[model samples]
Target: MNPSQNEVLTPSQLIFIVNGLLIGVGILILPNSLVKITQQDACISTAIGAVYPLYICLIITYISKKHPNHNILFLSKKYLGNFMGSIMNLLFLIPFIFIIFTVTPSITNILRIYSAEFLSPFKLIIIITGVCLYTAYNGINLIGEICKIIFYVSLPLIILPLFAVQKSSILNLLPVFGSGFNNILKGSIETLYSYTGLELVLLIYPYVNDKKKIKNSLLKGIFLTTLIYVWCVFITVYYFGLDLTSKSLWPVLSASEIIDIPIINSFRYLFMLSWTLILLRCITIYCFIAVYILKDFMKKTDTKKIYFFIYPILVFLSTFFTNEITRRNFLVKVTPIMVIFLVIYVSFIALLVRIKG
Candidate 1:
């Protein structure tokens, strides 16, 4: 359905949507990835790595502004012609579909390892995918509402990181910039996966009320996320040091354990609980984008049929990865390609649209 005026999202909702998608399971290992290469300068690396998502967001926003009434699917076919556009649609669709598979097992495993050992894998998969499907079937506006609710509610828990600073030694962050610009740059490249999900904006841009304000809204979202990432890295490095940060599987989670609040029996559990909400938001948004894209590509007015057919396959594919190594390998191998294709697809489509005009 074409978004009605009432369905249009405000800047705050847009920010919630973007930030929710951008911050997912990647945050857990981000400090380790940056510290492994840049050591104490991981924060600097995080700032630099943010440029990729920033640039991509600008490109998508620019394209959206030029075609405010149409979504990416319409723009692609209009500029690239049916055959090539259909090919591009399929290419873009792979990442959205694969994201469900990649994230489903990962989030489920995190719950199993850190929070809910009693929740069986089958139950976790069904509950997560089912909730996502039901949400997607309602439409993007509902997803935006869920995101707004989650974003505001999670503030208290997310701020728990501030308590971590008390346990950190400023000395641990000593000798900043010691990693050298080249090393920090290399580390920045490793953090690309953390910035992967902003492409969701391209699909949902038409739903945003103020098209002229998209660049401002997107930059705000990206900047906010950058602050969060740098804060996580700073606290983790300041507490754990480079050696320990590099060794920990999830430096942020380990760092959170240092917060000794009497009221909260375990800060780590609090972090995990809040993080599960964030991941659930991410998963739901991604599923909506996937079904939305397919529905548009197939020229269907409703997504109900597509949701039913696609989510079951998503459940089956998610189960294919039985262990952590396989999941890690799948992410490492697939993410770069998806990122590269996204860059090419957005740039090429934007260029074609400009030339034709």
Candidate 2:
């Protein structure tokens, strides 16, 4: 397991993995949150929020292509020495575990509220965590293959909105700035968490087959993801009105629920089905990243050996938070810190490599 320096995944496979991870159950909550950040120019704000991450993808892929064989862990350790590298690596790893524990409870609450009113969140949490942990234990290469399966589930997840367009009123967005242009950018940027999964490239680039294709795939990914997100936001805004869209947690699902289909019955159920894949993919991708980072640090042994130890830590830590609101609050507080680390982490590493070269 000496870094698996030769394991390189294709850019198409990487695109699916990143897309599957980014498009998650959060799609349901964003409309409401964006509105709260202030009922603004929904379409423009959503579109702008989508663009920021695309640029971020460019920066990461450029550096990763230049140093295709090295991961952030190696770069941090190399330039800053093991002590500083280990600290940053540990902080990075903390977010993954924190996310796992946080998101399971949140999805559990969603399932409880909308799908199964009586099911136990604890049981659902265990089952979801078990599947993700199993995939993660297999190592990075296998994880990429599983991502292909995730892509299939996600195909409809992206396309299902077309059926709802007929029912949407173009007039709802008439003023274009019900809340003003500046507020639109302000609100949408706050909800930019939609693009969180792009960072996975830092871990997976070391395994991509053609590092050059990584940038192209990232561009396609950000573009595709932004389009889907903007459409979802627009649909939510158009169908429900800013006030209602802002109020509902699952706005897209709610919008679909009310629209009538001729022969087919429940579009809401389809929305839920798509979201299940979203939830599973999100958790699994991050779990894979966390496990890989752990393997890199444990540097002395095979990742397969260390993975078993990692699963128990996830199970134990997840028990502290039992509700969605609390978990989301935790995610909000920690994510900005993670972003800052990534900025510093990616920049310092790139600078070090340039100096070394």
Cα-based RMSD of the predictions, in order? 1.8, 2.6
lDDT of 1 by residue, 1-357 (tens): 268765677777888888888887788778987887898899899999899988888788778877887877877878778888778888888987887787887788878878778998767887888887888677767788888888777768777777657766788876989989899899888888898888768778888887888888888889888888888888888889888998887777777677888778877887887778888888898888888778766664556778888878888888876476688788889889988988888888778768886
Choose the strongest candidate by lDDT.
1
In the range 199-262, model 2's lDDT, one tens digit per residue, is: 6677667777776788888877777777777778777887888778876767877777766666
Q: In candidate 1, which residue pairs clash?
A: none
In model 2, the clashing pairs are 8-207, 8-208, 8-209, 9-207, 9-208, 9-209
Model 1: how large is the Cα RMSD against the reference?
A: 1.8
Residue 333 C-alpha lDDT in model 2: 82
lDDT of each: 0.81, 0.71
**Model 2 deviation from native, Cα RMSD in Å:** 2.6
| Superposed model 1: Cα runs more than 4 Å off | 300-302
